[model samples]
Target: MNILSLGRSLASFIVVYGGIDLVAVHAFAPLRSLSADGLPRRRLTSRFSAGVDLKQNEDLQKYFQAAEERSLAQFARDDAPAWLQTIASLPFECTACGKCCKTIGSVYLSSEETWQAAELMNISSTEFIEAYASDIIRDSAEASNTWVRLKEKEVLKGTDHSPACIFLNSDTNQCQIYEARPTQCRTYPFWPNLLASPDAWDAEVRRMDHDSESTLLEWTPDAGGCEGMMILDQNSTTLGVPMKDVYRQLREYRQQDRYFPTGDKKADTER
Candidate 1:
């Protein structure tokens, strides 16, 4: 079927799956605090997984939290010319494997992204937020606020239960709002976790492989991570340059508390 047909079908499926309801969205408003060293520690609550011993999962959760903290630190240092050089030198390409979308935890939505996605889905922003989004409490020394992000759905795959972004269509393994996807979704593979250091990038490739077997076996960690996918030369590149620009914009957005441009000429010109 065509793209429009697929979108309509997916929309119908979403509604049937109760995506139109406002009460179903899971809120992750756990009280979070940052340590003296600037690492975030989230309080365990029933919202994550009910009827389970959080004590048993504490260590695992801490490890994942530390990884996020490390990535944030890397993002702080992204402006370094040497780091930019390293990023430019690395070889990379997206095969549209959809592995990242499947593996990532949450797709944080800025206010602009939320509105745009709602429009694309042909729904009011309030309805969209009620059905598909939730508020995440972020506490830090510099900023303490709540941000909206897409909710995850629990899907049973064989004997395992996997968490995926609500917009991910399980049958086709494609995003429903690809054209109007959030900046976080648009700026994948160039994330701080994958660009922090050579070792970090290598680790991410391994992690991706472990998460999704569809990732090519040839894209090994030792070969500089996603070997064939990387841009070998700076000349004649598209994604690489745009990704760098995105990286810069993300930094600016964080520092200035401003929304990224939505590429709407009329809207942007009006602003």
Candidate 2:
């Protein structure tokens, strides 16, 4: 190979596998110093969600690819706590499954989304905050920026009972306030956690399919955990949806969460 090609390869190797300082020092020249976790040393707003900015740096992309590969290898042996594994074999297709909504502490609405839901319900945001939302954070900049709690009602099904969103009708299993649902609810099944890897995908999806409080396998293969939902043969992402479209959906979701935090305050100004 040519000297130029060899140098480029060496730089890529140093960034990915090589440890210590000298992260992405090829063209940019010390854009980031090596941190304890081998990630870039900076006051990062986010690690993976900022797709646009992250993609601009070629070295970061290669570093992510290498890290993901290593994690997948570790997962093969450990098969526990499936973290850092990327690639959700197929795109997620939400069947309006209320399983996710039933889980406690699964949904939290942003400040702006909270008021929008209130207006739809004909209740003022003040009243809604008093009744529906919970004060998780107070006396801080992020105070009320997030941490709106929805109604958690207990519902009986035949022989068992499960916690569900107050808006979820037990008989029909449909969201009452679908139009006014928060961004977290709207971007179900495609959230970064769900898209980490196929194992995570199956574990999350199937666990939701169960009626009981789903628990991950703790001891052995046959242990206290969800077993009702069968391991699906996810041949294609949903049926007709393309992979690109799914990625695009996730990108849009991230962008919306990043740009429009409170509400459409700029809606009138833009118009």
Candidate 3:
């Protein structure tokens, strides 16, 4: 389908299956970031429904590629924060050991995320929210806002049940709905806290290992130890696009006012 058709289809699917209002879709449309080439970015916004398979859509993939480049350029800025600079200089590769999936705290879900996940699961949005999420109050810079977080399941070993993400498969140590996972899950190692410094990253790795009962894996400043993990440099890497860039692009979607409930001034008071 053409870009306009794709956008319309996504918008219609959300309204029809996800039960989102059209007005909300229009409000979110303007948040699409401009590509580095000065073209508008084609992103899957809040209006996107769960049924569209992004993997099969080549145009969508190109859009994602453009968006990734835009995110990477941000890190090259002279005024980039220290944390971002630290991350840019380091090489990170997900071992796919599922340690983060098993150990990290709750995965918060936005309203858009809830709907998309529900559609991916072939269930109603209300059903998905009811089954997987719980309400929590989050204190933001402005005020406390109510949000939903994905519920955790207990990893049973004999008699004890340890906390783990509900979507994590204990037997395989992988995410069940990885493709539809929330943005929080998608941006794993690049989290601001972990990128604070080398020591902070080491601390986070240690915590993940401890929580998931995995062997202690040390982080080497050089790219030598891990087999599956790729050493990301500006050149000479054949591991496709680096995950750091992909995660940053995914993160950009959340850094917009449209992602949150800005219309509800009472619930989300501006500072």
Best by lDDT: 3
Worst ten-residue run, lDDT, model 2?
25-34
lDDT per model vs. reference: 0.48, 0.48, 0.51
lDDT of 3 by residue, 163-263 (tens): 66788888988888775666556655545544445555455443233345555464332211232333344542334434345334334433432345453
**Model 2, range 78-174, lDDT digits (tens) per residue?**
5422332232335345555556666544355656567667878999988988877544323244444554556577555684555667778888879
lDDT, candidate 1, 82-162, per-residue tens: 455544334455655555555535566655457768888999988988999865324343242334667877666784545
Off by over 4 Å in 2: 1-91, 136-139, 142-146, 154-159, 207-234, 237-240, 252-271
Cα RMSD to native, each candidate? 20.9, 14.3, 9.6
- Give every collision pair in model 1: 91-230, 91-231, 92-229, 92-230, 92-231, 93-229
**Native-referenced Cα lDDT, model 3:** 0.51
Between candidates 1 and 3, the one scoring higher on TM-score is 3
Highest TM-score scorer: 3
**Local error of candidate 1 at residue 74 (angstroms):** 18
Model 1, runs deviating above 4 Å: 1-78, 86-88, 136-146, 207-271
